[model samples]
Target chain A: MAAAREFGVPLTLVGDRERVEAELARHDCTGLDIELWHASEVVGMHDSASDAVRKKKDSSIRVAFELVKGGEAAAVVSAGNSGATMAAGMFVLKRMRGIDRPAIAQLLPTLTGSTLVLDVGGNVDCKPDHLVQFAVMGEVYARFVMGLQSPRVGILSNGEEASKGNELTRETSVLLREKPLNYIGYVEGRDVFNGSVDVVVCDGFVGNVVLKLSEGLAETVGKMLKAEIKSSLLSQIGYLLCRKAFNNFRKTVDYAEYGGAPLLGINGVGMICHGGSNPKAIKNAIRFAYDYALKGVNSRMAEKLDESFPKSVREREANEAPADAKERVVS
Target chain B: MAAAREFGVPLTLVGDRERVEAELARHDCTGLDIELWHASEVVGMHDSASDAVRKKKDSSIRVAFELVKGGEAAAVVSAGNSGATMAAGMFVLKRMRGIDRPAIAQLLPTLTGSTLVLDVGGNVDCKPDHLVQFAVMGEVYARFVMGLQSPRVGILSNGEEASKGNELTRETSVLLREKPLNYIGYVEGRDVFNGSVDVVVCDGFVGNVVLKLSEGLAETVGKMLKAEIKSSLLSQIGYLLCRKAFNNFRKTVDYAEYGGAPLLGINGVGMICHGGSNPKAIKNAIRFAYDYALKGVNSRMAEKLDESFPKSVREREANEAPADAKERVVS
Candidate 1:
């Protein structure tokens, strides 16, 4: 809603009528092209993503996605159950043609601008081809959405060496080498924050753990700092003096600053926000949804997939064969 | 060397004769009952662990581990190549009886206190049995060394649900439930820093990544704070005032404070230090090694394994059966 007001974009709020109205009344939302669409239910955070989407047919998440599917809304943004959002997206928008699996792409704040990490709780046991598709989509998102001319893509592994990861990573590395993206072999976990690559791809299991661990660790560090500062009068005074610098530091690591992650490879634009997202995060998620739709990232992903894997019989043959023995060259 | 001097214990310094003498001279180790044992070779940081151990038979790491195996030293500690250290450990000390794989356990600083996370880059592809052993060893270390009674053990996964992780985690969770330790089931990555459990067990691949990623992010956050503070004159003054608090915060999160991770499941005590460990970190590592030897952690682990997996034919039969259909009840 804040994004709509700030960007002067038309927005439709889908949720319980009374609750939505109460929230709107609490804020000055006047003169903004905003409409409230009523939904009878909500998917709780602890609820199973697929089960909730299946049961709550008239859920706010479902209703919002319906609006996008019906051409009433260009995109849907939700700071709710992530699994439900992904389930609703797959159920409503469906996967793009030729895309085997969809991935969640999250932008991690780095010393340099940011690095896009994919499969952040989207697919758990990803195959070699699934990771290849993520690389292609991630590259497109990096170039078209993040505005990079050539994005360096890397498979997240235990070590930077090609032979350093588990079976999935080793297989994915072989496949990524065949793609058109600037595949940079493998990157260790430290490289995720070091900004060594634009896109770091991994199975959803590892990516999800990495994402949540980073959030938890950052919060832990902040809390530890506060506790130490308050332990002594001298440090307390020091903390007060450096309050501005600390606040600036907090902003740098704040999840709100990066907004929500985009559910890539879905047919339509869907932004999945952290469940603990504040108003600013919600606003940024909406902005991302709007920008993703405006940029036609999904369409571009489809094009990139087509370009990388032509529909010719030879292309299918190449995919069927072992990655190292591919006859046709990838463009 | 500092720990040996401070603790009034005799110390044997292993490395090149000239380098050891120079280091001792630089550190003012005048009358500390320290003897320098010369080794012709040193394992490079990037050297393959197993290959280096095989080739550099007279390397410092190899000689140090040999001392423990030969009863000349009660324990061995090295602030050198981790891979080489593990290799030297396995080659010299060998795995404990009934232990399938050795693991590295590191103490992670949490909000409340600290959480011990195991298999941090020891065995990359771990079996369910390996994780079960890690749980037992970790629990013992937490109790005997860290002074925690009945430490809660949890498996690190993407979700809290038993069915949420990959095949390895699911299988490991089942095995852990049958163990005598305080098994708390599946814990997500966030729980690692939340201090929700005393021991978080994971495959070495995931554990290593989490360890490195945390270190990298903590450093990144520190760097970002420094940069933000120096961006303006006012913030710099605030930083000076808060410098004491920040230093305390750094000490709290410092890897040196926790010393080094123990190489569990080995027949002898071996502590692995960070490659860039300073004199303080090395001193702490030596202290930990001495304490581990005094506590007889390895002997206790052997006894625990014997009790957990009895040598009776019935116990062997139970181990052979599927996890769900085990005949004999776990003690």
Candidate 2:
């Protein structure tokens, strides 16, 4: 709220106005205006949640998405069910040309800086060509969002050495190594932190696991350190003396530091904020979405789609892809 | 050095004897006992690390292993190349009976508590029986280490539905579910943090990917939080006022909280500490190894092996197992 108010952006509370007002108040954000978009009780916000956009004419999430889609709002921000938001984004705005599936891309913090991990949970089972597409999209996002000139693309595999990992990762690495992008060879899980690859691509199943595991570890480590420090008065005093250094260390590991993740390959700027997100994260997600829109991420993705995968690969997939494979994708 | 002196655990310093002694004096660890196992030359600790273990019989790592093997020391601790440590362990101490591949299992922090993640990076391509063995080993380790009775084993898959995941996870899930242990059907990556499953199992390739990704995310989130806390004076004050709480948060996310991960299924108590471990982590790793020895991990693993897998399955593997596979595995 402070960031939005600092930038002089008009902020409106779309859903449960009282709750939004109370939350803003807790953050001391009264300067940002609030409005209640109270729809008819009979045709309330829930109707707009479905991809069938016609169902709910006044659903809060649907109305907010509509504001972004119709240009009334620069960007839409929501902390609701991600599936509903993704559905509304696609059903109302649709996918970009030449893009087969949408991917959820996140700016993962690394030892060097931050790396982009794509398809975190959007697509569970990914074809080799779809992985290639994700690599291209991830590269572009890194170049724009993270300001990398030529991002290194890597397929997250079990091993860095040749002939390591399962069949899918091995095959994907082969395809990525053949691509024209600054594609590196196979990268292990450690490479994600070592800054060997700017864009790490994996199927959503693996990607989701990686994201959650990292979060869990971070929280665990943080708690353990405090317990250690609290065990003695001298340690507690030592913590206070080096508070600045510890604070510096803390800043490097926070999730809200990177803002929210962008839902890539979609037609419009769609962002998914953390469910327990505060005002600061919400403000950052909006800023990220605006920047993505300003960079024309969708059109650039369309232009780069062909360069990502060869025509031969596409033809092979078309011929060999099972008729029900797409439907078989869990999410 | 400060914590060790306070805790009364005599610490040993390796590498250059004179230089280490000088550094210890510099850090006021002069009272602490220090020893040096000088090699013929400086080991890169990365490239020739494995060779150092294989050829250099008097190297620091080798000496440390011997100390443990000969019962001169309770545990061996080294923050060197994990592959080298694992190699030295397998070659020196060997694997347990009926256990083909030795699994490196680590405890991951979760909301409910810490859950055991097996095969962090031990074996990439694993057979279904290998996973079953991991289940038995994990079940026993959890009972001894985490102290959970009848730990629920959930094979990591793309979905919770039994029929989901790749061929390996699916087959493993079936075998695990049918076992007498508390097999909890199938679980996804989310379940690792969801606190629903006590033991999350996967092939080494997938497990390593998950582990690295988790570490990377924690580091990222931890850093981001620190940065945000310092972005403004208000946040700094908020952070300062909650200094105890913040440090508590920091400890929770730190990797050293749970100490080292034991390379289970090995003949001896071989624990692999993280490469970036500090003195405190080394202490904990030593403590964990002591507990492991006291519990007789190998005996328990050996006891469970013959009964863990069905008679028909073991007979099938024995008949169909490749010659080289047999030598590498069930020796």
Query: DockQ: which candidate is best?
Result: 1
Candidate 2 per-residue lDDT over residues B1-331, each given as its tens digit: 5434544444444455666557666666556544454433333445544675667666566655555555455445557667667776666665665677788898887655878988886487689889888888898888777888778887887666554576677677767766768888777776786578888888887888878777655655556556655666655664555567556655655668777888776556667888778877777776666566666655665666656755644564332111111100000
Q: Which regions in candidate 1 have their CA more than 4 angstroms from the true location?
A: A18-29, A311-331, B22-28, B311-331
Interface quality of candidate 1 as DockQ: 0.60
lDDT of 2 at A177: 78
Worst 10 residues of 1 chain B by lDDT: B322-331
Instruction: Give per-model TM-scores.
Output: 0.91, 0.67
Model 2 chain B: weakest 10-residue lDDT segment is B322-331
RMSD to native, candidate 2:
9.1
Query: Model 2, retained fraction of real contacts?
Result: 0.35
What DockQ, between 0 and 1, does each candidate earn? 0.60, 0.22
Assign candidate 1 its CAPRI class. medium
The best candidate by lDDT is: 1
lDDT of model 1 at position B80: 84
